[model samples]
Target: MDKSAAQNSAAFLYPPIDPFDQRMLEVGDGHTIYVEQCGNPAGIPVVVLHGGPGGGCSPAMRRYFDPAQYRVILFDQRGCGRSRPHANVDANTTWHLIRDIELIRTTLDIPRWIVFGGSWGATLALAYAQTHPDRAAYLVLRGVFMGTQTELDWFYGGGAGRFFPDLWARFVELIPEAERTDLVTAYHNRLFSGDMLAENRHARRWCNWENALASIETRSPGGESPSDYARAFARLENHYFANGCFFEQDGFLQSNAHTLADVPGTIVQGRYDMICPPKTAWDLSMVWPRGTLTLVPQAGHALSEPGISAELVRVTNTLRSEAVALGL
Candidate 1:
């Protein structure tokens, strides 16, 4: 299909994710998580976990769930959009976020819901499933970020840095020259300093580099991302980093075999995706005995990529079909 035609497809827009679909639920320690519910109430549950440990939901998120087949639940992690304290760091910690996930699921009374997550969401799904295996029916994960030391090493410690020297340089440039070698530390120090201007600018630079890595070709469908997108993007990353991405091992490619060994999963990866790379998905397939790995040769990490979007819709359909096969 042509670009214009593909742009009109269901993946780009559906019932739509309402950024205003917000709810206030008080997590413990005076922290409240912002939750959003979409799709039909009686449909099979598909809980979505957005990236950024901090990127909140977008209307685009609604495209992942078939309105008639799956009930979608979305929420902003601590210190991110809509959630209270707006960049509040007091009780924001990895353990707190993990606990909050369980709390949200329990509150919704979701029994055996399918976990839909990408990037950091994938990591959270694994961790949540590990701690509560019986609660998770299965997982639909894309762009896995395991938070392993190696993955962190690659992103902050110079793996991704090697390719984006200029961005990396700017990240550390604001800090003292003597403290530049440990880029991640310098970045963390400044990013969490509560300097609004510095944090926002730094976040944009970090996101742009990742955005470039995400698409094999231009991923934007038509116009640029919404203006407030930068603020939303920055909020989540900063929250994730400050909170250790809600994991201790720095999660990517860590030993999750035992965690996901029995859980059925489908990993849809874009071969050309430079952001998370294809190996992450490949590695996941190796781990889950029941994982169905689909490689979109023409696509990359961008959800709107022509082939990738189509395949994801198909994956959702297939999962539903399989559920019928299993009499779920």
Candidate 2:
């Protein structure tokens, strides 16, 4: 395994968490969130927002932040993991997730901390920081996808499918050709037909396709499913579709950045990232006045891609160094 793909040794030099470190917080909206923290509590605080809108915590997530230099917090967003709901999408929404992050921050008494998230997580991190700009010290975002219509279109249309012809064929094989051309129709038909079998199949397909994306960028191929991947991914898709991703139009490119200019941000982008094009990162950089963009050419969407993970560690280190310099 490449050292870069592993969490930084300097980051984890401090005693790591116990084998079992999961905890749940109740936010009183029938909402309970699963959370775990590692690293130095006195060091700068850093929160890891897992992608998938549904992707939960991982042991690897702990490596991105220096345990000696950061209070690394990783958690399941609502029903995703360890949380009580178990992928239930009934009362979830984007704004709900935003408040959840803030609620966690307050519950932990963290006045301000760095937010690190990728893909959908990156979108939420930006949205949350934008809404509560004062609460965030900085942001480290990757594989930036800002819940835009074009992005959605790309996912259901030719964007991902064009790259993997065989996978596209398999995906389309799930639906009839007429409906295959209509992405929205296919999702709707499969997601809401009271067909548990079909929905589960759709969820499985979605999960498998995404897993393939992850595998492509992984240094070694291995993963353990908690048996909740489909339910969580489906729930996230269900959550987004319910709110239209809280976008009136192009989310990232629009007036949504009304508060982004007030925040300092750093973006680590994989130049070859196909899942969420690095263009989204470029678009974000132009709006965030105090933003810096680093392009990692040898990367895909996976978290463990070549030097991407090492760079993530570096980002966390830089943030702590900067914050301490600021007397944080």
- Using TM-score, give the best candidate's number: 2
RMSD for each model, in Å, please? 3.8, 3.4
Name the 10 consecutive residues with the lowest summed lDDT in model 1.
219-228
The global Cα lDDT (0 to 1) of model 1 is 0.68
Candidate 2 per-residue lDDT, tens place, 1-328, comes to 2455444324433334542345789865687888887877677877888888778777777767656667777888877877767777656777788888888888888888888898878888888887888887788888888887777777667787788777767656778877777765676567666667666777777666566655234422134333457757765765675466765566643466768676787888887776777777888788778879998877777777755766777777667668964335
TM-score of each: 0.84, 0.88
**Error of model 1, residue 48, in angstroms:** 0.4
Compared with the true structure, model 2 gives a TM-score of: 0.88
Worst 10 residues of 2 by lDDT: 215-224
CA lDDT of 319 in candidate 1?
A: 76
| lDDT by residue for model 1 (175-290), tens | 68887666556666655567777766666655655665565665322233333455556555655654466564544335656666667877877887656777877877777777
> Against the unseen true structure, what C-alpha lDDT does each candidate score?
0.68, 0.72
